[model samples]
Target chain A: MNRVNIVGIIVLIAIAIASPIIAGSFFAPPPAFIGPEFLVQIVAWGLIIGCIYVLLASGLNLIFGVMKVVNFSHGEFMILGGYVSYWVSILVGLDPYLSIFVSMVVIGLVGVLTERVCFRRVLGTSKLNEIILSLGLIYVLQNAMAISWTDKPIQIRSPFEFVTVSFGVVRMGLDWLIVIGVTVLIMAGFYILIKRTEVGRAMRATSQNRSAAMLMGINVERMDMFSFGLGTALAATAGTLLAILAPITPQAGAIPALKAFTIIVLGGLGSTIGAVVGGLVYGLVENSTIVLLGATWKDAIAFAILILVLIIRPTGLFGEKEA
Target chain B: MNILSDLRKGLKTPKIYLPILLLLVCLLIPLFGISPYFIHVLAVTFFYISYSSSWNLLAYSGQASFGHAAFLGIGGYVTTIFTIQTSIPWLGLLLGALVSAFAGILVGLTCVRLREWFLALVTLGFSIIMVALTIELHWLTGGVYGLAVPSLLPSVNHYYYGMLALTVFLVFIIYLITKSKIGLAFVAIRENESEAKATGIDVTKYKLLAFTMSAFFAGLIGAFYAHFISYINYQIFHLDYSFWPIIISVIGGIATIEGPIIGSSLMFCIIEFLRVIRPLVETIDPVIKLNYPKIQVLLMGIILVVVVIKMPKGISPWLRKYLISISK
Candidate 1:
C-alpha cells in the first residue's frame, strides 16, 4: 500500500531467499550440495506443519474479525479438541481420523458455550478485559484438562502409523498426507460457507461493520456465536491433526497457540488469506532456522520474524486497520 | 517547595497512613518469633507486592504487558551470572536491574507504536524468545538445572526485612511518579492516545518511560527473588510468573498504589491456605486431592470472571466505596 512497506517486503523476500544459500555455503557438509536434500526435508516438514498453523491462525483471525475479541484461550480449545479425539478414539475404538469430526463438533459446542458465558458479556468492552478473561479461561481449560487426563504427553495412534510414502526424493508419512488433505478440504468448505451461505454473509457483514449489519436486521448476536464456534472448530481440527502428528499434552497448546498468534499478527490481524500465507512462511522460517542455527532457535526465529514485520509494518502485511 | 507542599497535602489525608501502619505491622511480625516458613512466605509476599506494583505502573500508562516475566527472568539471570563471574553481590544486583532496563527499552522500542492486543502479543513473543535463548545458551545459564545465587542476606528474617524495605521504597517512588506531571501524561495517553497526541504530549515518550521504569523495578524484585530463593532458572519466564502479577493486580485494584500490595498479600495467603488444607482435604476425599491443582485454578478462573463481570474496579476501590457509604 505504501513505498516503505513494498520495499520492506522485497528486502525480506531477498533475505529469505539468500540466507539458506549463504548459510549452506559456509556451513554445508564436507561433500557440499548434500545439504539440499536436508533443505528439501525441512521444506516438506514445514509445509505439513504450516498446514496445521493455517487452520489455527485462520480460526483466530475469523473470531477477531467477527467478534473483535482476541481469544488467548483458543489454543486451549485446540488442545481440548485433541483430548476429545484421543478419548473418543480410545473408548469407542474409532480411528483417530474419524474421531476428528466428533472432536470438532464437541469443541464447537464448547466454543458456543464459552462465547455465551465468558466472552459475550465483554463483547464490546475494553480490549484489556477480553485479554484478561481469555487468560482466566486458559488457566481453567489447561488445568482442567491436566486434572482429568494428567499432564503426561500422549500420542493418538493413527491407523496409518508406520506408513510412509516417497515421491521422488521427498518422503512423508501417510498420516501427514491425510492431515494436509483434510486441512485443505476443511478450509475450502469454510470458504464456501462464508462465500455462499446466508450465515456466512452475516458473519462477513458483521466483521465489516457491526452497526451496519445490525441495521440491516442481521442477528449479530447469533452470528457472533456462530463465528466463534466455527473458528474454534477449526482450531479443534488442527488439534486433532496435531494429536495424530505429535504428542498431545494439556500444555501442548501453549507454544502453538503463541505461534498461531504470531501467524495471525504476521498475516494481518483479521485476514484469512493472510493467515494461510503467514502460516506457511512461519513454518518454513522455523524449520529452516533449525537447519541453519540448530533446533533451539526454531521458536525464537518465528517471533523474530513477527517483531521484524511489526516494526516495518505495524498493522501486519495484510492488516488494513491501523492500531 | 512543591515536594514539601505535596508531602503536606498527602499527610493531611488520614487514609494515607493505613499502608504505613500495615508496613509497621509486617516489620514487627518477626518480633513474635514466627516460624521460618511463615517468614519465607511473608518475604515472598513482599517481593510480589513490589513486582505487581511495577506491573501496575505500566498498566497505569495504559499498556498491559503479558510478558513481564521477561524482565523478571532477565534480572534473575543477569544478577546470578554477574555474581557468579565477579562474586560482587551488590554490583550484580544493580547491574541486573540496569541490564533488564536495557532489555525493556529494546522491547519498548518495538512496542511503543503498537496498541492493545498487538502490544500484548509482541511482549509475549519477547518473553518466549528470552526463555528459548536462556535454554539455548545453557553453558552460561546452567540450562534446565538452573544456577544458585548467593543469599542477599543471612536468615529468613533478613530477607523479610530487606524485601519489606524494598517494597516500601519502590511503592513510594511509584506513588511519586503517579502524582507528577509525567504520570499525568501516562494517564492522558491511556485515556485517549489521539487526544493526548493532539495536545502535544509526545505519547510515545511517556509510554517508553513507563516501560523502562516498570522493567527496572521488576528486575530489582527478580534479583531479590533469585537471592531469596537461591535458585534461578529459565522456568522463571513461565506463564505463572506473568499471570501472578496480573491476577493479583486485578484482584486488588488496577492502576492503584495500594492495589498490588493488598492483592499480593491476599492471594499469597489464599495459596498458602490452600496448601495448608491439602492434607485435610486429602483425608476427607482422596479424589478431590488428586484434582487439587485443577480446583485451585478453577477457583482463580471463577474469581477472575466474577471480578471482571461484577467488580471490574477491583477490591480496593470497591472497599473504598463501601467504606464511604458506611460512613455516610
Candidate 2:
C-alpha cells in the first residue's frame, strides 16, 4: 500500500475505536458488546459501506476522467440495477448472488445504448449543454421507473440465512461479510484490469488526450462507449449489492449518487484508488456519525464534508486538474 | 393614408407594441368566463416568467446557478417563518428579500471565483444542502409536511393581480438592464471572459452584480409565491423546481428580455395541457390508467433533447429572425 493508503487506514482504525466510546458516553445504550467486538463491527460496517461507495465513485470517476462529462443519471442507473435484481429474483427464484452476472450483462448493454444514443451526440459540447441534457435524462429515467413501479420503497430480502461470525469479541451478520468480501473482490479485479489489460491502457491513453489516442490508432468512439458502459455497469452492480444491504426504491439512487459524487470529488476525480479511499472515508464519516450522533444528521454529513473538500482543495486529494 | 402610416410605424416597434398587446389580453382573461383554477395557473405562469427572466439575467452573464432554488427557498421560508412564527407579513417579505440577497452574495462570492462549470456545481451543491436543511431542520421549515403561510392578498384575484403587477415590473426591470451598457457587459462576459476582463470590464463585479440582482428578483417573486400559495414546503424549493427556470431560460432563448416570458408561457401551457390529457383519457377510455407524472417527465426530457439538437440558439432568436425576414 502507498503512504496515503496507510495513513487513511490508520486514521479510519482510530475513528472506529474512538466512535463507540464517544457514543456510549453520549447516550444510554444496551451493552451489546464491550471493546473489541464493538470495534470490529464498526470497522466492518465502515469498510463495507465505504467500499460500496468506492465502487460507485470509481465508475463515476472513470466517466468524468475520460469524457469530462458528468452523468447526472448515474444514480438512476444504480436504481435501475436494483430493480433488475428485484425482478430477476421474483422471476427465477434464484439467489441474488447467482443473478449478479445477468444483472451486469443487462445494465452493460443499457450503458452502451445510453452512450451511443444520447451521450455520444453531445460529446465535445459545452459543459452547460451536457449538464442540462444529463439532468433531463435523469428526470426521464426517474419518472419512467415511478410510472412502471409505483413510487414505493421495496425491500429485496437477502437470501442469506442469519449467520454471525464471532472473532473473539466481534460478532455480526454473515451478510456483512459477504459485502466486504465482494467489495474486495471487485476492487482487486478492477485494479488488475486497469493495470494489466490492453483495454485499460487504451483507456489511460484516451483519458490523457482523446485526439492523441485516435492518432495512435485507438478507436476513440469505441473507447468512449466502453468506458461509459463499464462505469454504468459498475454503478448498477453497486446498486444491486446495496439492495442486499437495504431496501430499494425508484428514487433510492438519488442520495447514493450524491454520495458517490462527493466521494469522487473528495478522492480526486478519475483516480481509481482515490475513489476507493474516498469512499471508505465517506462511509466511516457517515456510519460512525449515525452510530454516535443519532441518525438525523447523516445526509448533512455527506454534503458538509463535500463542501469543505471543494472549498479547501477543489482539486481533491489525488485529483489532476481537468481541461 | 395617415392611419396606414401610423400603423406601419407602430409595426416597426414590435417589442413595445407586442408586450402591451399581450398584457391587455392577459388582463381580459378573467372577463372571458375562464375558471379561477385556470386563472391560478396563469398567475403561476406569470410568476415563473418573472423567475425565469431573472434567471436569464444571470445566464446572460454565463453563470448557471443551481443554488437559485436556495434563494427562492430563503425568500419563501424566511417570509413564512416570520409571518407564521411571529406577528409580521410585510416585514417578513422585506427581511426575506434581504436574507435571500445576502445568501446570494455569499454563494456568489464563493462560486463567482470559479469557472462557470464549477460555479454551477457549487450552486447545485448549495441547492442540495438547502433541501436537506429544510428536511433536517423540521422545527423551522416544518419538514416534509410543509408550513402553512398567511396570504399577502385576501383573494385569488388579489393574488392574480399581485403576480401580474410583479411580472410586468420585473419584465421592465430586466429590459432596462439589458438595454444599457451593463447588458453589453453581460454579453461580453458570456462570449469570452478573458477578453472581456482584459478590455477593462470588471468581470468579477459584473458577474456578482448579475447574480445578486437575479437573486433579488428571484427572492422577491419567491416571497410573493409563499404568500400566494399560502403554504411552503421542501418540494417548492427542491432542485426540481430549481431546474425549471434554467430550462425555461434555455428553451426560451437565454438572455433575451422576452425569452423567459415566452418560455414560461409555453412550459405552463405544456404542463397544464398535458395534465388534462390524463383525466380526459381516463374518462373517454377507461382501460388505460394514464400515468401523467411519467408522461410529463418523459415529454420534458424529449423536449430538452430535441431543443438542444435542433434549436441550439433557442426559440426566441429564431422567432426574431423569422419575423425580421418576413418584414423584409
Candidate 3:
C-alpha cells in the first residue's frame, strides 16, 4: 500500500483502538450500553454532519470537475435551500423530508440562473476573476437571504422526531436515520447519473476536455450549467436535512461552506472519492475536537488540518498532480 | 541612477499634482465646519482605503488572501492585550503591526508554494483558526465578550486627520514600491510565474516580502481602527473585514494604487449614505422600510456583481476612460 493509504489506515485503526481508552475522558462512560451515551452520541452527530459534508463536497467536486471554477458561494445555495424547504414545510405543510425536493427544484433553478448569469460571463477568465466574481455572488445571495429571513434561526420539525434507534451504545433519532438514508440515496443516484447514463458520459467528457467534448457533439456550456445546477441541488438537499436536524439561520451556511472548502482541499480538488473521505475525516475531527478540546476550537481545527494537508500534500489526497 | 531618474520623472508628471490638490481640499473640508459625524464618515473612508490597499498590494504581488482579517484581528488583539499590560498605546500599535507581520511570514512560508485557490483557502482557514484560538484563550483576549481597547485618538477631528495622514503615508509607500524594481518583480511573477522565474527572480522571497508587507499594513490598520472605535473582539476577524478590502479593491480596481482609494471612498460613501438615509428609504414602502438594512447591504452586493461583470478591472479604469475621452 502507498504511504498515504497506510497512514490513513493506521489513523482509522488508532481511533478504533483508542475509543475504549478515550472513554474515560467522557462525562459519563456507559457501564452498559443503554439509552444513549454522550460519547457515542457525539460521534453519531459527527457522522451525520459528515454525511452532509459528503453531499456538499460531491456537489462542489462535480461542479469543479466540469466548470473548473471554484464557487465560493456554494454554501449560500444550501442556506437558500433550507429556507425554501422551510417555506415549503410551513406554506405547503409538506414534511421536511419531502420538502427536500421542493428546495432542490427551487435552488436548482437559482443555481442554473447563477451559472448562466454570473459564471458564464467570466468563464475562461483568470482564476482571480472567477474567485472575485463568486465573492460578489456570495454577497448578493447572503444579503438577499438576510432580507427575506431577517437572520432568525428556524428549524423544520421532522415527523419522526420521537422515534429512536439504538446501535450498541449509539442511539439516534429516526430523523437522523432518514438524513443518512437520503444522503446515501442521493449519492447513489448521483453515482448512477455520472457512471451509467449518456448525460453523465457527456458530463465526464466535458470535464475531461472541453474542446474534445465539443468535438464529440457535447454542448460544453450546457454541461457546465447542468453540473452547476446539480451541484447546487445536492447542496440544497444537505441544507434541508441540516435544517431539520438543527436550527438554521441565514448566515449559518457560511461556516459549513468554508469547512467544505477545507474538505475539498483535503480530498484534493475535483476528486469525488477524496471529498467523501475528506468530509468524513473532517467531520469526525471537528466533533472530536469539540469534545477533546473545547467547543471554541472545533471550527479552527478543520482549518489547521487544511493548512497541514496543503503543506504536506499540496495536490491533496486524491487530486491529480498539478498541470 | 535608475532611482534618481525615476524620481525626477515621477515629480514632473501632472498626475502627481492631482493627489496634492485633492489632499489640500480634504485637509480644508473639516475647516468648513462640516458635522463631526460627517468627518467620522470620511475617516471611515480613509480607514478602508488603507485596508483595501493592503489587500491590493498582496493581489498585485500575485497572492490573494481571503483570510487577511486574521492579520487584522491579530493586530487588534495583540495591541489591545499589550496596551492593557503596559499602557503604551503607540508601542501597542507598533507591536500589533509587527506581530502580525511576523505571523504573516510564518503563514507565507506554508502557503508560498500553493496556487490561487489553495492560497485563498489556506489564508481563509488561517483567519477562521485565529478566531477559534482567540476564543479558546479568552482569559487574556476576553473571548467572545471582547475587551475594550484604549481609543488612540482623542476626538473625531483628530481621528479624521490621523487616518487621512496614515492613508496618505501608506498609499505613498505602496505607490513608491510599485514604481520600483521590486514592484516589477511582483508584476512579472503575477503575469507569468515561470517566465518570471526564468528571468531570475526569486519567487519565494518576493512572495514572502509581499506577504510580510501586506500583513504589516493590514495589522496596523486593524489596530488603529480598533483603537479608533475603542473595542476589540474575535468578531473583528470575521469575513466582512476580509471581504471589504476585496470588494473595494475589485470595485475600485485591483492591482492599481488609485483603485482601492477610489473604490473605498466610493463604496463607503454609498454605504454611509444609504445608512444615513435608510430611514427616509424606509418611508418609501412597507417592504422597503422593513428590509432597509438588508437592502443597503444587498445593494453593495449588486454593485459588486455589476462591477465584476460590466467592469472587471473596476470603477477606476472605467472612470479614467470616461474622463480621458471627455478631455480629448
Candidate 4:
C-alpha cells in the first residue's frame, strides 16, 4: 500500500522471475534465443513449490499466533490431502485438478470438526499437553492413511500430459503451467480473504487478543475453527501441488513438513508475508544447496542455516517482535 | 503422636515400593528359562526407561528438547572411542555422561533464551544438524556403517545385570531430584515462567540445571546402550531416536518418575508387538506383499492420538486410577 511496500513487492516479483533465468544461465543453459516455453518450465516449478510453502506456512502462522499451538501434524495433513486427491481422482475419473478442490473442502471440514471436537477442549491446557495431543493427532492421521492406502508410492499422471506449448526456442509442460496459474489464483484469493473479509478481520482480532475479541463479541471459538479450516484447506491445496510435483507415499510429508517448520521459523511466526518470503528463500536455498552440494549435504546446509537463524534471530526474517 | 499425619503423607506420595517390588520380580526374571530374545528386549526396555526418565528431567521444566539423541550419540561414541582405547570401562561411562552434560550446558547457553515452541524448533534443528555432522565427519562417527564398541560385560546376563544396576541408579537420582526443592522450582517454571521469574526464581539457571542433569543421565543410558549392543551407528543418534524419548515422556506423563518407567516399557513392547505382525502376515501369505514397518509407524501415530484423546493425563494417571479403583 505504501511506497516501501510496493517497492518490496516489486523486488520480490523481480527476484522470483530472475532466479530461474540466472539458474539457467549458470547450469541449465538454453540456446541464445531463450524462448517463452523454457522460461515457463523453470519458473512454473519454482512458483509451484513456493506456493506450497506459502499455503503450509500461512496456516501454520495463523495456528501458532492464535492458538499458540505448533501443529507438528501439519505435514501429515498435507499428505492426507494428496491421498484424498488420489482417492477422488480414482473414484470419479475426473481431472486431478478437480480432485484438488474436493480434497481442500474435505480437509477444511475435517479441520473445523477437529478444532471443535478436540482442540477447543485443550485450549487452556499446558503447552506440553498441547504438543503431545497434536503429536497424537499426527500419529492417528498417518496410520489412518496407511490403512486406507498402502504404504507403497502411488503416482497420478497430470491430465495436462497431452498438452504442450512450444515457444520456438523451448518447450514447456502444460500441467506445470496450470499448477502455477492455479497456485497464483489460490494465493491471491487467500491474501484477499485474509486482508479484506470480515472473517479475516475476526481472525486477525483473535490472533492479536482472544479475550479482547471475545469481549467484543467476535465468537473466538468460531474464529479458531475458521482459521483451522482455512489452514487445512491451504495445506490440502499444497498437497494437491505435491501430488502433481512428486509421487505420493505415506511418509511423503515427513521431510517436507520438517523443511516447512524451518521456513516458518526463518520467515517469522504468524506472518503471512513472512511465510511467502520464507518459503521462496527456503525453496531457493534447498534448490541451490542441491545444485551446489550433493544431496547428502543439502539437509545439513538447510538445518545449519535454520539453527544459525534461530540463534541469531529467533523471531524470523519477517515476524514482528512481540511487544 | 503424629501417626495419622504421617500415614496421610505416605498415602499422598507415589507408591515407589510397588515398582521396587516389580524390580525384584524383574531381577528374578533371568531365573526362569526365558528366551535370550526376551532378555534382550528387557535390557533394551531398561535402557530406554533410563533414557526417557532423563528426558523427563528436562521436559519437567516445560522445555521439550529435540536434540536429546545427540547426548546419546555422545555417550555411545565416547564409550566406543574410550572402551577400545582404554581398559577402564567405568571411567569411560562416567566421562561420557560428563561430556554430554557439558554439551547440554553449551546448547542451553545458546538456545535457552527462546521459550516454548521456538526452543523445541531450535533443539530439533540442532539434532538434525548433529546427525548430519556425525555422517559428514565419518572419521569420528564411522558414517552410516557405524562402529562397534568394546563390551565390558562378557555375557548377555552380565550385560542385563549392568543395565539393571544403571537403571536403578539413574531412577534413584531422578527420584531425588524430583523430590527436592529444585523439582518444585521446575514445576513452578513450567506452570508460569514470567510469574516464576517475578517470584525471584532464577528461571534460566533452573532450566540449565535440568538440562545438564537430563543430559548426564541420557548420556549414561546411551553409553550403556552402546555397550549392550557393542555397536553405535549413525542411525542410533538420529533425529528419529531423539524424538522418541520425548514422546515416551509425554505419553507416560510429564514431571513424574513412574511415567517414563511405564511409558518406555509399554512403548518398547508395542513397537516389538507391531514388528511381530510383519512375520505373521508373511506366514499368512508369502505372495502378499506387506510394508509392515510403515504400518508399524502408522500404528504408532494412531496410538499417540488415542492416548492423547483418551488418556491426556498419561499412562501413570490411568494406572493410578485403576490401582486405586481395585483397592477400593
Candidate 5:
C-alpha cells in the first residue's frame, strides 16, 4: 500500500526465491547449484510445467473469454481425457500421442454434453451457481472415474522412455521435447483458429458481446456450447500430455486445474502472450519453491502470489481493465 | 434488545412453526431409539447446515468463499490446541471464533476490493496455507496425523442435540442480522456495489461485517466438527470441506435460511443411507465387497447434477411454492 510496503514485499520475495541457491551452495558438498547442467534442468522442468499450465489455463480462459463462465471442472475434463487415452493406448497399442485425438474428440463431445445438461442452466444466473455446479461436476466425474478404473495412477509407458535429447548442457527426455512441441502446436493452432477463421471470428464476437453477436446473426448459445467443447478439448490435450509425461490418476486434476486459474489471473484474461508468460512464471516459481522449500509449499506459494497480485494490481500484469 | 424483540415478533407467523416442529422432531428422534450411527450422521449434517448457512450469509454480501475450510481448520486447530493447553473447551471455542473473525476481516479487506473470483482463489489459497502451517508447526499442532480433540458432550445423544441447538441458534442470529439495517446494507452492496456506494451505505463496512460474521460461525461449527469427530488433523483443510458447504448451499438454494437446513439434511440422508447400506451388502455375499462409498458418492453427484438441471433455483423455492399452493 505504501512505498515501503511495496519495496519490503519485493525484498521478501527475492529472499524466498533466492534462498534455495544459497542453502544449496553452503550446506551441500556437490556444488550443483551454480552448475549450468543444474540450471538447464531447472529451466527444462520449468518450461515443461509452464507449458502444461499454459495449455490448461488457455482452455479455461477460452471459456472464460467467450461465456464469462468459469468451469472449475476443466481439469477433470483433462483427467477424463487422460484416462480415455490411457485405456485406448493399452487396448489398441496406440501411443498416447496418437490417442490424444481420440481423447480430444471424445472429451469435446463430453464437454458439449456437460454444457448442455448442467452449466447451460446456471450459466448466467450468478457466479456462485456456476462455481457450485462445477464443483459438483468434479465430485461426480472424479469419483466416477475412480470407481470405474480404480484410484490408482495410470501410466502409458512412453515410446521414448529411455531416450534423451541433448543440447550441450541440456539433456532432457525426448518425451518432454514432444510434450512441449505438441503444446506449442496446440497454441499455434488455437491462435490461427481464433484470429484467422470464420468460426473463430464468431467466437470473438460472442466473447465481445453476446447480444451484439446475436444481432450480427451469430447463434450465441451454439457458440457457448462450441467454445465449451473446444476449451475442454484443449484441457483434454493437456491431460494427455501430462499422462505421457507422468503417471496420472483420477485425483490428479484438482491442484493443476487450480494453478491454471492462478495462471490465467496472473497472465491476465484474453491475452495469449499473457497466459503463456504467466504460466511459465508460475511453473518456474513453483519449481524454485519446491527446491527452496519443501514440496508442500508449491500450491501455497502460488496462491500467496495470486493473493498478493490481486491485492496490489487486480487487473494483473498484461490485463486491460474490464468494461 | 430491539433485534431480540424483532426475532420474537417473527415467531407469530405460521411459517415459523415449521422449523419449530422440525426442531422438536429432531429433539425427540434420539428418545425414539435411533442408532448412534444415525445420530452421528445427523450431528454431521448439523455442521454442514451451519457451514452452508455461513456460506450463504457471505454470499448475500456478494462474496463467495471457495476455501471456507481455511476458517474451519483454523477453528478446529486453534480450539483443539487451546482446549488441550488450557483445559477449557468453551474458552477454546470462543477464542477460535474470535481468531477466525479476525482472519475474515483481513481476507475481506484484501478481497472485497477485487473481483469475486479472487476471493474464491484467496480463500482456497488460505486453506492450503493453513494445511502447510499445521504440518510445519507439527510439534504444537500434531501435524498431518492430527491431534486427538476432546469432546465436550458426553455421548452421541448429547452431541446431536447440542449440535442441533447450536446450529439453530447460529442460524437465528444470522437471520436476525439479515433482518437488521446491517443486513439491508449487505443486500444493497450485493445487488449493486456502486449503487450502494452512491446511496451512502458504507459498502466496504457492510461487506466486511458480513464476512466477519460468516467467518465467526464457520469457525465455531468447525470447532464443533473437530469435537464431533473426536479428532483434529490437516485433512480438515481438504477441498472437500470447502466444497461441501458450497454444494450444500446450492442444493438448498443459496442465500436462503431454510435452503441450507433442508439441503444438508436431504443430502446427508441420501449419502449416508447408501453408505450405511454398504456393509449390509458386503455381509450378504463376502465376495462382493462393492466400493459403495465411491459408488454412493457418484450417485449423489448424478443426483446433484439432475437437481441442478431440474431445480436450478434449488429445492427450497419449490417447497415454498408447494406450501403456498396447498394453503390456497
Candidate 6:
C-alpha cells in the first residue's frame, strides 16, 4: 500500500524464509534436516496442516464477515465434528471420509441452533457479550463432549490408513492426500457458493451492509444463520480431517482454534483469500519453526508472528477497516 | 475533628455501613470457629473476590481480557521463584506484582489500539505463549511438574485473615479509583474512545493504567494462591483461571463496586453446594453421578448464557433495583 508497508512486508517475508536456515544452523543441529528430503516432507506437512487451517479460518472469517460475531467456540464445533465422525465410523461402519459429510451436516445444524438459541439475542450487543457467550459455549460444548465421550483422545482410523502416496522425492500418507484433496474440494465449493450462487450473493451483500441488505428484501437474519452454519460446517470438516491426522480430544481444539483466529486476524478479519494465504504462511512458519526450535516453540511462534503483525499493522495485512 | 465528623456522617448512611457490616461478617467467619474446610472455602472466596474485582476494574475501562490467567501465572511463578531464591515471602509477593504489572504494561502497549476481539485474542495468545515459555524454560520454572512455594502464613486462620485484609484494601482502592476522575476517564474511554480522546483524555495512558492495576492485583492474588495452595505451576495459566473471573464478574455485575464480591460469594457458594450435594445426587441418579464432575462447569456455562441473554447487567444491579423498588 505504501513504501514503508512494502518494506515491512518484504522484511517479514525475508525473515520467514530465512528462519528455517537460521534455526537449522544456529539453534539446533542441522542433522534433523537430511537435505531436501526433510524440506520436502516439511513442505508437504505444511500444506496439509495449512489446508486444515484454511478450512477452519475461512469459516471463522465467513461468520465474522456476515454476523460480525467472533465465535470463540468455533473450534469446539470442529471437535464435535471429529467426535461425530468417530461415532459414525464406529456405528454406521462407514469410512471416516464418507462420514465427514454427515459430521458437516450435523455440526452445521448445531451451529445454526447455537446461533439462534444463544448468539442471536446478543448479535448486535456489546462485543464483550458475544465473546462471553462464545466462551460459555466453549465450556458447554467441551464439557458436554468430555461428559459423553470422555476426555481421552480418540483416533478415527481412515480407510486409507495403510496406503501411502509418493510424489517424486516426497512421500506422503494416503490419509494426508485425501485430507488435502477434501480441503481443496471444500474450499472450491465455498468459492463457488460465495461467487456464483444467490445465497452467496445474499451473504456477501449482508456482510457488506446488513441494514442495506435488509432494505433490499434479503432476510439478513436467515443469512446470519446460514453463514454461521456454513462457517461451522467448514470448521467441522477441519476437525474431521484432524481426527484422521491425529487423535481428537475434547481440549485438542483450543490450540488450532487459536491458530485459526490468528490466521483470520493475520489475513484480514473478513477476507477469505487472506485467510487461505495466512493459513499457508502460518502452517509453513509453524512447521519450519518446529524443525528449527523443536515442538515446544511451535505454539509460541504463531502468536509471536501475530503480535509482530499486529504491532506493524493492527488492522491486519489485508483488513479494510482501521484498527 | 471535622474529618472525624464527616466520617461519622458518612457511616450514618446505610450505604457505607452495609459494606462495613459485610466486611465485619467476613472477618468474623474466622472467629466463628468454622471448620478448616469452610475456612479454606472462605479463603478461596476472598481470593476470587480479589481476582474478579481486579478483572472487573479492567472491564470498567472497557477492556475485557480473555487471558488474565497470564498475569495470574506470571505472578504465581514470580512469587514462587523469588521466595524460593530469597526466602522473603513479602518481598517475593511485591516483586511478583511488579513483574506482572510490567508484563501487563507491555501487553497493553500492544493491545491498547486493537478492537475488542483482537484484544481478547492477543491477550489469550500471550497467555499461551507464557505457558509455552514456562514449559520450555523448565530449568527455571520447574516445567509442568510445578514448584512448591512456602506458605505466607502457616495457619488457615492467618491465611484467611490475610486474604480478607488484602481483599478489603484492594477493593477500597479500586472503589476510590472508580469514583475518581481517572475512573470517569475510564468510563469515557470504554463508552467511546474517540470522544474521550477528543475531550483531551490520553486513551492509551488510562487504558494502560487499567491494565497495569488489574495485573498488579491479579498478581498479588496469584502470589497468595501459590502460597495457599503451596504449589505453583503452568496450570495456573489454564483457561479455567481466566474464565472464573469472567463468570464471577458477569454474574455479580459488570462495572460495579459490589459486583465481584457478590458474584464471587454466590459462585463460591454454588460450587460448594454442588460439591456437598454431589454424592447425594449421585446416589439418587446414577446418570448424574457419572457426569457429576462436569455438572458444575455445565451449570456455569448455562448460567453465563442465561445471564448474558436475560440479565446482561448482572444480578447485583438487578438486586439493587429490586430492593430499591421494594423499599419505595
Error of 2 at B176 (Å): 2.1
How far off is residue B210 in model 1, in Å? 0.6
Q: For model 2, how does the per-residue alpha-carbon lDDT over B48-118 read when each residue is reduced to its tens digit?
A: 89988878888888888865888888899999998887876688877887888888887787766665455
Clashing pairs in 1: none
Worst 10 residues of 4 chain B by lDDT: B285-294
Q: What is the interface RMSD of each candidate, in Å?
A: 1.4, 2.5, 1.3, 3.0, 2.1, 1.1
Residue B267, model 1: Cα distance from true site in angstroms: 0.9
Native-referenced Cα lDDT, model 1: 0.86
Model 3, span A67-158: residue lDDT tens: 99988898999989999999999999998888999899889999999999989998887898899888988888888898877878999888
The model with the greatest DockQ is 6
Q: What global local distance difference test value does model 2 have?
A: 0.78
Docking class of 1: medium
The A-chain TM-scores of all the candidates are 0.91, 0.88, 0.89, 0.84, 0.89, 0.93
Give the least accurate 10-residue stretch of model 4 chain A, judged by summed lDDT.
Answer: A288-297
Query: For candidate 5, lDDT tens digit of each residue in B1-328?
Result: 8876765886886777888899899888999998898888888888889888998899878888988888888888889999998888678888888898999999888777777667788888888888877887889999778999987989999989889988989998888888788888888888888999999998878888888999999889888888888898899899988988877777787778888998898887788676667777788754336566777667767767777767876888999999989878
lDDT of 1 by residue, A132-196 (tens): 88988888888888888888899899999999999877788999899989989999999999889
Model 3 chain B scores worst on lDDT over the 10 consecutive residues at B7-16
lDDT of 6 by residue, A1-323 (tens): 45644554455466567766775586567664468988899888988889889999999999999999989998999999999999999999998999989999999999999999989999888999999988888988888988888878899988779898888987889888888899999999999999899999999999999999999999999999999999999998999998999888998887788889988887667877778877877788888888777787788887877887788777776665656
What is the overall TM-score of model 6 with all chains considered together? 0.95
Off by over 4 Å in 4: A1-47, A161-172, A318-323, B1-16, B84-91, B268-300, B321-328
iRMSD (Å) of candidate 3? 1.3
- In model 4, residue pairs whose N, Cα or C atoms come closer than 3 Å (at least 3 residues apart or on different chains), thus clashing, are A139-B301, A140-B301
User: Which of the numbered candidates is closest to the native, going by highest TM-score?
Assistant: 6
Which is the winner by DockQ between candidate 1 and candidate 6? Answer: 6
lDDT value, residue A171 of candidate 5: 84
DockQ of every model listed? 0.64, 0.43, 0.73, 0.39, 0.54, 0.75
Better of 2 and 5 by TM-score: 5
lDDT of 2 by residue, A151-218 (tens): 78875677774777777767777888887787788778778877799998999889988889999999
